[model samples]
Target chain A: MLEIKNLKASINNKEILKGVDISIQPGELHAIMGPNGSGKSTLANVLSGKDGYEVSGELKYQGKDLINIPIDERAQKGIFLAFQYPTEIPGVNTNNFLKTSLNKIKKARGEKEMDTLSFIKMIKEKSNELGMNENMLSRQLNVGFSGGEKKKNEILQMKILNPNLAILDETDSGLDIDALKTVAKGVNSTRDKNKSFLVITHYQRLLNYIKPDFVHVLADGKIIKSGSMELAEQLEKTGYKGIN
Target chain B: MLDFKPNEKEIEKIGKFSIEEKNFRIENLKNFNSVGFPNKLVEDWKFSDLRHIVSKNFAKLDLKLKPSKEENFDFIKDFEHNYIVLVNGRLTSNSFQHEDNSQIVINPYLNKDFSNKKEKNPLINLNYALSIEGFNLEVKDNYKFNKVLVIYNLFTKDLNENILNSQNRIKIGKNSELHVFDYVINKSEKNFFNNVYEDLYLAESSVFKNISIQKNRSNGFFHKFSKNILSSKSNYSSFIFPLGLKFDKLDLEFNLEGENIECNLQAASFLNKGDHQEIKTRVNHLAPNCKSYQKVKNVIDLDSKGVYQGKIFVKNIAQKTDAYQLSKAILLDESSEFDSKPELEIYADDVKCSHGSTSGSVEKDSIYYLMTRGLSKNESVKLLINGFLSEIIVSIKSKTMKNFIEQKLLSQIYEH
Candidate 1:
């Protein structure tokens, strides 16, 4: 469902990712483990089509060129990125924002838009599944939200949007054990043959709940090793420096 | 260019007046004629530069009142309340169906008080000299209205290159409560200038709330100077949404003359191309234990200029005075400009006073975040702008009023 080869991305002439390659098939969940400054977030941003990045080499999604697509178009094509730190947007209601985003994607796909009643009902159901307070959706988007609440909000958005390729960039960071489990459950429920997942993290804790099909160790802008769940277990015992 | 300076003979043509009133008008006229219109040289008019703006836009400034074209009034269907209709700055009709008629008094304003000191503002001087139309409203003591008072300030289609000056006075008695909505609707097809002077007084323990807004876009050059006085324990709050005019300025002054008085002022506006607007306020804490707050926000687009000058002053005897002022602006284009001046002067050592001003283009990260959610760049910017300005609107306590204002403000942002 997604492919990248020799993807060298730099910002302001400072290279962050140098010749990285990764490929995932439909229904597969891949976990990328790395230490600080290992370009884990950079890879996620480049895949989401964020601006101000000088990227070269091959990057394809669904066998189509993904490099030239704008950020919104990428999202319209079923690509979603759960931010590590969701923006605190004051005066924009969380429910209203979610509805707008969903309707935009729907309109782009030539589908009928959802009305307010159905949108509210769906949001309540999804938020309830994530164990979120219904009151949070009525407040300003991420403004004054707890760290865990913000993370769950991102997951809830992912579930509502229901994208094909979901990239979770450190969605486990700043989350407690309970929130981590809830986020994992949210991801696990949406797993199907046609959907793919890219879980980026520094630790293997999130992988304990949402088992990954493959594990890759990214260090110094390159992936040095690739294996299965055993690889993540080994990295937990020995630090990233202990890798070959 | 045609002469804007009015001759002394024009004063006599307005109406018959006492010798003292005639002299007062002539003195103010002289004050205005000395400086045809305030330019950049004047301290308060520095950012506005009215002389240059007038010279560029108007060839002649007619001081004669024109007959109204008799257009049907469009009352707001969103809510029901009392209304006072002013056609071309002249009080045409009024209704008080929602209140006790005996507790309220309304009349046409005839400025007979000639005991005030000479004014410094040329525009005020011009208004005092030429203004012959407006309203005078008084609420009885210990009475609260059952509904909001809607003041419909309407301009007719017959006004072209004309100037209209009017004065309004509102007095809230002791222990009384009043709420007002100053709604302006203009249908003039040609350019005209409007100058207004408003005098308001809040007696002891009175509560007064006001909201001012424009109904639509118009070819009007508008200016209003409001002077407000608050007595002991009186509370006053004002919300202004002044938009869709070629040039508009609101010069407001509030004086807290008694202890434990509360004063609040907030304004939000969206200025599009060729629109120039200014909100200048001076809040004076003359008595002990008074608190005042002011916040102004603006979203300015291309070729539009927005200015805010707010000042707070505390007297030496006014201990425990709390004053705060903040101004925020987002310029949508490089050519759009915003100027803010916040000043605080405190003579009381125990008082807490602070002021802040910030102006910048919209944050790129915010736009990118919204765009990532499947919104186009234009939609994202509009959403951010609406969100930024709506912070003030969210503070309104009435849900019905808040929803109505939200719809109006949303359309203003989307249309731009």
Candidate 2:
């Protein structure tokens, strides 16, 4: 579902990701665990086609070159990135934005757009399953929302859009235990053979909820080790310095 | 440059006035002719070079203009209310079936008080000199209107290189209440100028709310100077949506004359396609325990220019006065321009007065976040602009009125 080889990304003439490589098949969940500023978020940003990055690497998604695609086109082509710090957009109702976004993606993919009635029904169901207050969807997008509510809103978006490849960039960082479990449950419910997830995290707590098929240790902009859940447990015990 | 200077014959054409009124007209006309149109040298006209803009746009401006045809205009079907229709700044017709006729007095404006005050704005001088038509509205004491009054100011298509000046006054008696929607609809295809002078007086314990908006884009150069006086315990609120004109300027002044008055002024505008707009306001806290607030927001597209100059003054006797002012702008492109100046003058040490102004391009992070949700760059920027302006629109308490104004605002944004 996704492939990368010798991926390097830089901004302002400073290199952040250097020769990092990762690969995942359809239905596989991959985890990239790294300490602070280890290019984990950079990888997610570069994959989602954020501008201002001087990127030179072999990055392919679904056997197509993804480097030249614009950010919205990549999103339309089934790529979703859950931001670490969700933006608080004032005066924009969450439900209205979601509807516009869903319809745009739907039109780009040659699918019928959902009307307001059905869209409301679908959103109500998805938010209810995640135990989010229905009123949150009517308020301004993430404006005055709590940290946990913002993260859960991101997961709720992931469920609504139902993208092919979802990149979770530190989605579990600020969540409490209950929120973390609900986020995990939301992710677990959407797992299927046709969808893929690249869970990027700094701690092993999130790993205990939704187990990853493979885990890679990212240190100093490079993946130094690749293993399973055991690798995350080892890192929690010894830290990044213990690996070397 | 075309001569905007008017001769005495034009004043005579208006009517036979008393000696005092005639002298007032002659003095103001002389003042207007001396300055012609205000230039960038004037402190209040620095951001707006009216002299240069007028020279570039008009070859000749006719001072005497008569409506040639009975123009048709659509009354707003969005809400039920009483309405007054004005064509080319001349009051044409009105209906007040929703109110007690005895409590309401509406008539063609005849300037009664000929008190001569030296005016600094040349446009105001011009209005006083050549003004002929408008409406004088007075509500009887303790009478509250059952429905909102809609003033439909329409400019006909026959207007070309013409200038129209009018004076309007609205007085709410003690303990009376009124709400008004000043709707302007222009059909003029060629360039014309419209100058308006409005006076509002809120009596003791009276309440007045006014919402002013433009219907669509037009080839109109507009200027309006509104002066409001508030009495004890009276409340006055104004919302202005000035959009889609070749050139527009609103000079507003409010005087809190009595104790415990509350005054609020808010505006949201979308300027595009080389449109120019300026809003200058001065609010005076003359009484104790009064509160005043001013907020103006603008979105300027390519080649458009927007300006806001707001000032708050608190007198020495006006202790415990609270005043706040803020101006925010979003420039969409390099060619777009926004200029803001906020001023506060306080002689009362116990007063609370604060002012702020900000102007910048839209946030790149906000665009990126929206794009990640499958919205294109254009769509994302549009959504952000709408969101920025909707903060003001949502303040309208009536949902139907809010939606109507929101649709008009959206059309202005999308027209670009």
Candidate 3:
């Protein structure tokens, strides 16, 4: 469903991603594992069409050239990025934000928007499954959410949007064991033959719950090796230097 | 002390009219002629230079007060209120269908002279001097008013430059409750000046809530003043939303005369495309155990400008008084500006008083996050602005009124 070739991106003319290549088929799960400063987060941001990036390479999503599209258009086309650091917007109700987001995407897709009652019911069901408090939907989004609550909320957004491909950029960091399991469950529930997930992380802990179909080791902004889920087991034993 | 002159020709002919029969009117005219207008030399009128807008030769054009039009009163028709309509500064109708054993006394005119009543402010003096008709709106003692009373001040387009002057005194008697909505509509096609004065007195154990909306189109200028006095065990709440006017200088004052009185003063103005609005407020705690709270917010874009000056005073007898004041603004453009001054004057050693003011542009992080949720840039910015002002708008007690104001705010945002 997605493909990247020789992707080189930089910020402020300082190179971050030298050359990277990855390919994912529909219904497949791919995880990028690396050490800190390996450009894992940079790749996720570049793929999501964030600003202030000098990017060059061939990136295709559903056979469309994705490099020139705007950030919101990319999101409307079902490319969701679970932010590592979510924004705290005071005076903005969480329920209203979610409803507006869903309607925006639905309008872009030429689909009928859900009414208020149905939208509330669906969000309650999804939030309940993610172990999120119903009251959180009334408070300002992420204004006072705990660390785990913020991550869980990101996953909650993922479930509510039902995107075709969701890039979880370090979705497992700073999460306790219980939160990690809940997040993994939320990610696993949305897996389907037409849906894909690119999980980027520094450690293999998240792979333990949501096993990936393929594991790629990214070193110095380039994917040096690709293997099966057992590859994560090997990386846990040996460090990045020992991977080669 | 400035060399400003009275520009309105009709104002100079006030002696020819019979309304000068009252001594107060003549004193007020003298005050207006001598004092002229407010300028930068005055401390309270520092930011708003009335002389700049009301030029020397701008006469109050002569126009006839015609009958009411349907469109002039459309915006406030849906609200649940006792309707009081004024056409060209003249009262046309006062009706109340819902009365729960309440006494509402309306005196069409005030006999006393109030020219020397307010000596410090010249614009207020001008209002009283030119005002031909006045209203004494009061609720008798121990009588609770169930319906919200709405006074609609509307204008009709005329060839002559219009100057509207009207005074109203509202009194909520002991142990009574009342809610008021003062809505001003400028349906005139050309620019005019509207100067209004309102005096409110809340008796002991009475509750009063007021919401004022000034929805004037482009090139309209208004100078408004409202004075309030709160008695023992009384509660007073006021919310002012000034959005659509080209230029506005509004002054509000509250005096806590007795113990156990509570007052809330709030003002919000959203300006765009060179629109200007200024709100000045003062709250005095004269008795012990009284409380006052004030918050003013402004949002401006393009070349608009907004100003807020708020002060809190505590007398020596007002020991154990609690007062808080805050002013905040959001400037959305480099050319847009906001000026705020929050002051506190306390003579009581045991009183608690604090004031704060802040201004800033929209947070980039906020915009990016909203855009990531599939909202366009314009949509994202609109949502942020609305959310920023929702804190003050949500405080309105009536759901319909809140919705009405919200719609007005949104339309103003998008229409530009």
lDDT for each candidate structure: 0.91, 0.93, 0.83
TM-score for all predictions?
A: 0.99, 0.99, 0.91
Assess the local accuracy of residue B180 in candidate 1 as a C-alpha lDDT between 0 and 100.
Answer: 95
**Each model's DockQ?**
0.80, 0.91, 0.71
lDDT of 2 by residue, B128-175 (tens): 998987999999999999999999998888898988999999999999
Clashes of each: 0, 0, 1
lDDT of 3 by residue, B216-272 (tens): 555567788889989999999988888888788888888899999999988777789
**In model 1, where do residues sit more than 4 Å from their true spots?**
none
lDDT of 1 by residue, B1-416 (tens): 54578988898888878889988899899889888888989989889999988988998888755547557978988888899999888888999999999999999996778974568788899998999879999999999999999999998877888999999999999999999988989988889999999999999999999988888888999999999999999999988888799999999999999999999999999999789999999999999999899999999998999999998999899999999999999999998999988888888999989999999998888887787789988999898988998899998887777887888888889997
Clash-forming residue pairs, model 2: none
Q: Write the per-residue lDDT of candidate 2 for residues A1-244, one digit (tens) a residue.
A: 9999999999999999999989999999999998888999999999999999999989999999999999999999999999999999998989999999999999999999999999999999999989999999999999999999999999999999989999999999999999999999999999999999999999999999999999999988999999999999999999999888
Model 3: DockQ vs. true structure: 0.71
Q: Evaluate fnat for each of the predicted models and list the values in order.
A: 0.62, 0.85, 0.62
Q: Write the per-residue lDDT of candidate 3 for residues A22-42, one digit (tens) a residue.
A: 998999999999988899989
Error of 1 at A197 (Å): 0.7
The C-alpha RMSD of each candidate to the native structure, in angstroms, is 1.0, 1.0, 3.2
Candidate 2 CAPRI grade: high
Ranked candidates, highest lDDT first = 2, 1, 3
